[model samples]
Target: MSRLRRAAGRIWRVASIPLLAIILAFIVAAVVIVVSSVFTSTGLDVFLPLGAYGSLLAGAFGSGTGISNTLVAAAPLILGGLAVGLGFKAGLFNIGVAGQFLVGAFAAAVVGARLAGAPGVIAAPVALIAGALGGAAFGFIPGFLKARTGAHEVVTTIMLNNAAVLLLTWAVNDLVRAPGFSFPRTGDLGHSALPILLGRNVHLGIPIAVLAVFSVRWLLDRTTNGFEIRTVGQNPNAARYAGMRPIFITTLTMTLSGLLAGVAGAIQMLGVIGFYAPGITASVGFDSIAVALLGRSDPIGILFAAILFGAFRAGAPLMQIETSVPVEIIDIIQALVILFLAADLIVRRVFRVRAAKPVISELATVTRTWAGGAPPGGGA
Candidate 1:
């Protein structure tokens, strides 16, 4: 019983800030709704916020399908959040998940589309590998540059994001365009579709994503390389004194981050789209930054945070149709979550909670990154 209590306390400590942040975000959103109604012809609708939230929650958990939709939407988010979360552990800000996601999905589509009649066992794994390689290759570039040239990852990654979209758009239109389709889309993924789960739209990637969370947790907490990564993130000079190679760890962490994101793209291709198309990412790469911050850069925390974000997405359309509230409200709430996390002191003061900062956080890493020319170990 004592063990159970300790575990519960541990979970609560880790979860308290994010949970409070989410609650505060919704409260603020409610106020926004109440205030906005005053400017409209409807006058002050004090119940507007309650109505909107009702619609959102109902749409997210109202039926079997709603729950399934949440799971399906959450799959890639879990991967994307883990990707960013892992980078935070190593003190690397990987803002190129968008590019990596695109490249991976495209690669998976190319290979999967060619396997016209292959068995699921054979086709699925190969295309997944191609996607992983594609994402890793993109990830490696920035890592290599940052490690060797003292180039900041933020700039290089942002530029690459644009390049990837343009390049993929061209390829989809000209190189791999489906024979019958006039749109900028890739060929059909002939037999590489991931197996559906429980006769629902959910796919193999859902379990894979959950598995990835555990895998990442184990990697960070139960491995020697994990210790080195953490040490480098906390202090590069100290890492050098301990005889660890910061350059290699920097490169490895970024590459691994990309690999996870690439897998996200691959499964999204095989399980969801079955073809690559422009705008397919729908800003998932960007939203994942908020998810990482909400999760405080922990794998387990990322899982819960991703699910919450996914709930918002899965419920947005119905929230719009039912309450006449725009889907953009979801974006505002997400931004608010980030703001609360970045300024956790406000959360602590408001909630009357007392706790020290963790060993690491996405907010800290981001601040250090944007404030400097070169990352610590990578610069030297």
Candidate 2:
């Protein structure tokens, strides 16, 4: 009985902040909606005055198509969130997910285009692997710099992001442009290279994303490497004292994080876009940071957080079309969610919720360890 009660309490504390933040964001969004309605002279009242929220619901999950779209949108986000979340777990900030994602997509496009005649079993996995490798390769740059020179991953990753955009532009224009096409894009992926899943828009990526959630959970909770990662993240000094190499751990964590981000790009390409094109990614990598933060770097929490963001992305169009409310409202609401989470004290105070004591030993250790300065145990 005591164990059961404690378990429930743990669950509540884990879930309460995000849940309350979301609710508060929505309440504020409703107010924004009302204000926007008042400003618009020519509006349908959405055909019902109280129908803005209803429209959002209908657009996101009112039908099978909506649900599928939401899932599809969520797939890449889940992967990206996992990438960032994994980095957070290791006391590292992998800000290069955007670059990793783009490079991965570019690699997948090249590989998928080349494998136009292969079987799905052969082509799909290879394309995805190519993307992961590309991301890992790019990820290595920052990780190596950090481990060897003590340079900040944040600065390196951000610079790499800008470099990647130029690189992607060059790759598309000079190398992969489809014959006789004016626009910058690779050729269509072979039919077999296309996603095999529920329908045209939806793909196997959803299942893959779902699988990733469990795989990551198991890795973090039940594996030797996971223990090492946690140990290094919690106390690099202790890890060094215990004979663990911080350089290797940091490099590997960034590599794996990039791999996940790369997989996200590949999934989005093969599963949704069916080809590589410039601007295909609409800041999915940046959004993943928010997802990771909202999810608190937990795998399960990331999955749900990704889904919520996906719903917003998937439904924004319909919500705008029906209610005449600008789609930017969704962005506002998302920003509010992040703001509330960042100001947790405000949320707790508003709700009169008691703060939970820290239970995890390694929590927030990442905030201080990135500069590669001496570890807590007095090691370099």
Candidate 3:
């Protein structure tokens, strides 16, 4: 009983951080709404917090269509969040997921367009594999540089993102532009390539996303490679001393992470858009970083976080129409969640929670120390 109690306590400690942050964000949003309401002719009682929340709920879950849309938006987030979370566990910050996603989607579009007349099973799987390869190839660059030259992955990955944008623009315009369209986008994917789940709009990607979450959970918690990743993340020096190769692990982890992002792009293209364009993903790659952090780098946690964000996204338009509040407020709410998580000390202090020992992200430390010209003892 005592042991079970301790295990329960540990789970709560891990879970409570994000929960408190989310609660605090909503409370602050309510205060903002109420304060802003005072300026209206209807006076201080015009915009009640509960009313805003009710509209949000109604917009997100009131009908089958709303739920389907939410799931559609969430599917990419699950894979993208996993991409970032996987890097976190491996002691690497893969900030180039956005670039990887773009390249991957482009690759998928090219392959899928060519496979227009193929059978569904062959075309769908091939397109997904092509996307994974494209993303993995792009991810390899930063990892190679970080491992070989001691250059920071942050710097390399950010530069690579800019490069990817240019590459995508050029590729779309000169290489894969649809034969008769005015817009610089790829041709629509064949019907065989698209997977339908609920209706025309919602696709089979949701189940695939859920499967990815479980696969990642198993990879990290029950596999030898996962053990290596966690060991290196915890202490590169210790891993090196224990006969592990840091460079190989770092490169491999980034590649795998990029592979996940690539799969996200493929799913988005095949399941949602049915075509490729520069802005099809909107900000999913960037938003996924927040998702990974808010989920505390856990695969299952990422699934739930992605769904919450998806709910906000799905409901934002209705919330705007019903409450006369700007849809941008949802962005503020998301930002606040990240802000509070980044500064967990503030949450603990505000709630009088015990000071839990911090989980040090070794990548952060390595970045700081390496830039100062003295590589740490562990081969990082």
Candidate 4:
């Protein structure tokens, strides 16, 4: 009976996270809509039909186009979320994903535009590789500095973001600008870019995003290297004592994290923008950090969280159109989700009262008996 109780407790704890996250998100969304209505003199009447959620569903899944747009938006988020999630598993804060993403977009744009005669099959792969390389290189710098000179990654990454913005702006404005136009953006990537997937502007990057989520799941859960990374993250000193090199692990993890972030940029450039622009990749990388946090850093959780965020992003415009709600309401709700997720101890306290001490002691006895061991006091 005690053994069964413990098993049930474990299951409940595992199930509570997603349930709480969804509930909190809805509650926050409702509050935002109500506030918006009150301020706009509608007093909840304008937020009708679907109540506060009408715009959300309409923008995300009301039509085939909406659903496709959501998926398209989810692509870069998956990549960026994976980058942050992987960094968390290695105990590294990869706040430089924004910079890495910009570097990737620039690199892919330069490579793809130059390869004029190459087929999509060839050009796409080369551009992605270039983006990945650029992102990896950017990530490696902070890792190197952290390992060798004790420079914190957060500061270095944030500084690098400003530098990346300037550098990309210059590159697009001067080097990669289209001949007939004076726009501060790169030349358009032609047919060698991403293929249209749904006969709409949505591209094949959606499938690639799904595959990346599965790949990241497998890598973290099934691979030996992943085990080492987790160990290092949990306790660097213990990992070092167990004959693992912390420095090497840190460097490798950051590199891979950056590579994934870069892929997001490449997909955005090739599939969405078809060109590299200074502000095109704005805030997506930072938003991915929130996605990773809301998902609890689990790969599958991150995928769902990415979709949720994508839905908000896709639906924001509709929310503004149909109701007086500001598009910034979605941002507020996302921020609230991250805040609540980070404060999970409060949720657990409210919803999961601890089992009494006597109950816990009784459960321990049963567990020991099942394990073929005597109870703590020696009597069976």
**Which has the greatest TM-score?**
1
lDDT of 2: 0.81
Q: Between the candidate structures 1 and 3, which one is better when assessed by TM-score?
A: 1
Superior candidate under lDDT, 1 versus 3? 1
Location of the lowest summed lDDT over 10 successive residues in candidate 3: 369-378
Cα lDDT tens digits for candidate 4, 1-380: 99999888865655465557667877877765665666566665534535446877798989888898888888899899999888877767778899998898888888888864688888887888898899999888877776666566778888988999998888777777867666676666775488887858678778887888899888878998888777666656677777777777777888888888888888888888777776775588899988777665677878988998899888878877876567887887777777766566687688874433322332343233234342111111
lDDT of 4 at 357: 39
Question: Can you list the residue pairs that collide in candidate 2?
Answer: none
Using lDDT, give the best candidate's number. 1
lDDT of 1: 0.84
| TM-score for each candidate, following the candidate numbering | 0.94, 0.92, 0.92, 0.87
State candidate 3's TM-score. 0.92
**Model 1, 157: alpha-carbon shift in Å?**
0.8
- lDDT for predicted candidate 4 compared with the true structure: 0.76
Deviation from native of the Cα of residue 246 in model 3, angstroms: 0.7
| Tens-digit per-residue lDDT, 235-318, candidate 2 | 787898888878888888888899899989888888777777777764889999889878888899999999999999888888
Q: Residue 94 of model 3: what lDDT?
A: 78
Q: Candidate 3 — which residues are off by over 4 angstroms? A: 1-4, 38-43, 355-380
Alpha-carbon deviation at 277 in model 3, angstroms: 2.4
In model 4, which residue pairs have backbone atoms overlapping below 3 Å? none
